[model samples]
Target: MLNLLSNLICTALLSAPVVSEPANPKALPFEVSAYVTSENKIRVAVEKSAPESVVVLLRNSKNEILFQEMISKKELKYAAKLDMKNLTDGAYELEFKSAQGAIRKQVNVATKPVAEPARVILMNTPAE
Candidate 1:
């Protein structure tokens, strides 16, 4: 009887399931995303759960406004391509504000230097 009771308790513990808490308990109603494209440009996208007014701004390291736009509430989705060709190599900030909340992202611009090809010389007088 003692061996049978121990076996039943071990089986119950092994068959139990484990539960874990989620990383983010609360969910946001809106989503924002930005990325750099191949043509030296930034692509901004925003999706909202409901139609609401949103303000988007792009500022430089000095907090100077480079570009600003107000999205109308009538639009549910928004996408834009910001030109970065004329921008200097530095830090920039992108901000989005709406009724749900606000979000900010930092971007760094840099240019790679080009390397020159090496030169080679040949001498044929020593062959005689």
Candidate 2:
């Protein structure tokens, strides 16, 4: 009987306790969208969710940087428009960097032939 109790106590003492560590969390926020205008100009819209300053960079498929600029905003959302009239038709990428996060998005710009000048007029007529 004494031996059985001793074995039980020894088994309890030899068993290890499970320990858990707290997890570390971090903030991440960034977005980018690209669109081409009717005049063949590429417009890149950048959105940020942080209040800290950020840098927007544009690069081509060859890994060559085309343009870069710094922006600062107090709000959580902000946008920056880039004009690419002189850029060649190809695939491009936009890199967004902030104090908290960094993101990249791919964009494609197609070539358009030159045409005659035309005017666009919007007429609003009230209907019954």
Find the candidate with the highest lDDT and give its number: 1
Per-residue lDDT of 1-128 in model 1, one digit per residue for the tens?
54333322221001111112222213444567787766667788988777789888888899999999998888889999987767777777888776656677777776553445699998778665
Lowest lDDT 10-mer window, candidate 2? Answer: 11-20
User: What is candidate 1's local distance difference test score?
Assistant: 0.67
lDDT of 1 at 118: 97
lDDT of 2 by residue, 1-128 (tens): 54333322221011121111112112445455555444444465655665577677778899998888777665555555565545666777777666665666666665444345699999999998
Instruction: Estimate TM-scores for all models.
Output: 0.70, 0.52
Off by over 4 Å in 2: 1-27, 73-77, 112-128
Q: TM-score of model 2 relative to the true fold?
A: 0.52
